[model samples]
Target: MSILDDLRDRGLIQQVTDEEGLEKHLNEDRVALYCGFDPTADSLHIGHLFPALMLKRFQEAGHRPIALVGGGTGMIGDPSGRNEERSLNEENVVKEWSNNIKDQLSKLIDFDDAKNGAVVVNNYDWLSQMSVIDLLRDVGKHFSVNYMLAKESVEARIEHGISFTEFTYMLLQSLDFLRLYQKENCTLQIGGSDQWGNITAGLELIRRSSQEGESAKAFGLTVPLVTKADGQKFGKTASGAIWLDEKKTSPYEFYQFWINTDDRDVIKFLKSFTFLPLEEISELEKSNTEHPEKREAHRKLAEEMTQMVHGKASLDQAVRISQALFNGDVKSLSKDEVALGFKDVPSFDLEESEKPLIDLLVEAKISSSKRQAREDIGNGAIYINDERQTDLQYNLDDKDKIDGAFTIIRRGKKKYFLIRH
Candidate 1:
């Protein structure tokens, strides 16, 4: 099947500006496409993964992909569907985020000069230099205020009030595309469906800025916004954003995130996220019918995505940690491993000296009250490092430490704890 055919089969095509035209363009040698990523945060979260995945798909299909970081546009946050204006981050903060975002994006797309190698660009380079008059006379005249205001992004903010900084966001963003189109010969832009307005704006800028009858034209495609079956935003847990960076989120937590994908969302996610062959995925799905409890499909999805994002070693580490936790073998992990493995697991820290097991248990809020903690220990519901602690007087001492470190506690069958050394 052709590239567009594959994209269609995989359900990646959300809304392309002109499907026939775009397919025709891609049939040519190495279609140059670009996607914009706003460096609004220090690390690219799972929310950013859709575009990156799309870019990866395009490159694998023998197209050049360019990633644009919204260094300049990030300063004036895109007011797309925001109920309130975003707090503008400082220049230094945005710059640092832009660089860090670049690093994160680098991990997702290959930057080598082979395999339709991806190129990275920052909007700040061009947007910072354009004079107001230069922008208005040269690019702004092509778009009417009426057309801009008609967009849902702008119209939604009309009642809430949008700042001049935010209102001009499209202009800055459009310039990124125009600049990349000029510098990299990029012809297609892709992003989340919310970026349709911005992408179309960039296309208009490109169509207008070229010389009279200049044969320069481009297209826009957007992926659907991922939402949970539960109607919650994707990429969010109770703890917050699932970052690509390990420092912000552990591989263990990341692994759990994918493994926890609801039954309704798993197949859709596999299609959107993984580069797995369609037939193989279909067969995997078929297994669900034959053996429901295996959760084999979910396991494969979790492993593939975890390894892709966190590398094999991290996935292995996470899996090993998973095994250790499942078998109630807390002794199998060292202090550092325990920390990383259970970072999201419920826990409380205390000095080994001041570590009254009751106080620690009460403080972790694992137990409802100090008396309850004592009672639970007496009831044989309490475990310290997987060993049932029958004594209420069990003051945690260094002698009971794991590698001179923690005492894992459990108040019930589900809850877990880690005490510090």
Candidate 2:
């Protein structure tokens, strides 16, 4: 199957400009495509996974992918897909974030291209050099205020308020495309569905900037906003984003996130996020129908993606930690391992003065009341660092330390608690 066809079969193509024309363009050898990511956060979250993975796919399909960082546009804050205008970030902050994300992108794409290799560009190099007059007279003339205002990106905020800086974001994005097209012949742009308006603006700028009849029309493609069947956004836990950086999100936390994927969204997620072959995914789906407790589908989904984005070592460690948690083996863990493994478990603090262990247990949310805490201990429902503590008189000691940092507490089989030192 063609790469585009494969993407469609996997439900990656939500919207595209002229499917036949795009197919023709893609059928040609070595098409150059790009997708821009903003430096809104220091680390990329799961939401950025689709576009990054798409870029990798394009490279593997004998195309070049320019993974551009929005060092320029991020500062302006495009209001696309947002309810309100974003808070503008400091230049230094954006630059630092942009650099960090660049390092992260290196993990996924091949940047050392002699031919059809990936490229990373920081848009700041061009945008920073433009004076107000050069911007207004040169690039701004191609875009009409009516056309700009009507775009869903800007128009959606008309009822509220849209800042001029944010409204001009499309122009900045278009300039980046024009610059890329002129410098590198990039012919396709991909992003999330919210970027449809901005993508078209860039395409139009390319058409206008280049000579007519010689007009090199570019294509725009987007993925649907990742969502759950219950109509909530995906890739977020109560703690916030599931980030790509290990420091921001431990491997154990990342594994647990996918292992806990809502049953309603698992198959869809397998299709969307994973690069596994259709036949293989279908086979796993079949197996899941028979024995879901095996969680075969979730396992493959987590394994392939976590390995692709993180590394083989990380995926292995995540699986090992998961097994340790499931087995409730304390001796199998070290101090750092304990920290990374129980990173997401609810944690509480203790003072030296607390007495009876029951009061402390109730305060740590292990039990509803002191009486229940005592009852739980009597019945052997509580554990410290995976060891069952049946005695109500047992108090924490330095010997119980995991890495001299914290203690893992368990209420039942699945629920966990952490007491930090």
TM-score for candidate 1, residues paired by index: 0.93
Residue pairs of candidate 1 with colliding backbone atoms: none
Q: In candidate 2, which residue ranges exceed 4 Å CA deviation?
A: 212-214, 346-373, 392-399, 403-406, 413-415
Per-residue lDDT tens digits for candidate 2, residues 239-291, read 98899998899877888888888777788889888877888888888888888
lDDT of 1 by residue, 319-387 (tens): 888779889897888787788876767666674475677887788887889989888988999988888
Which of the numbered candidates is closest to the native, going by highest lDDT?
A: 2
Error of 1 at 399 (Å): 5.2
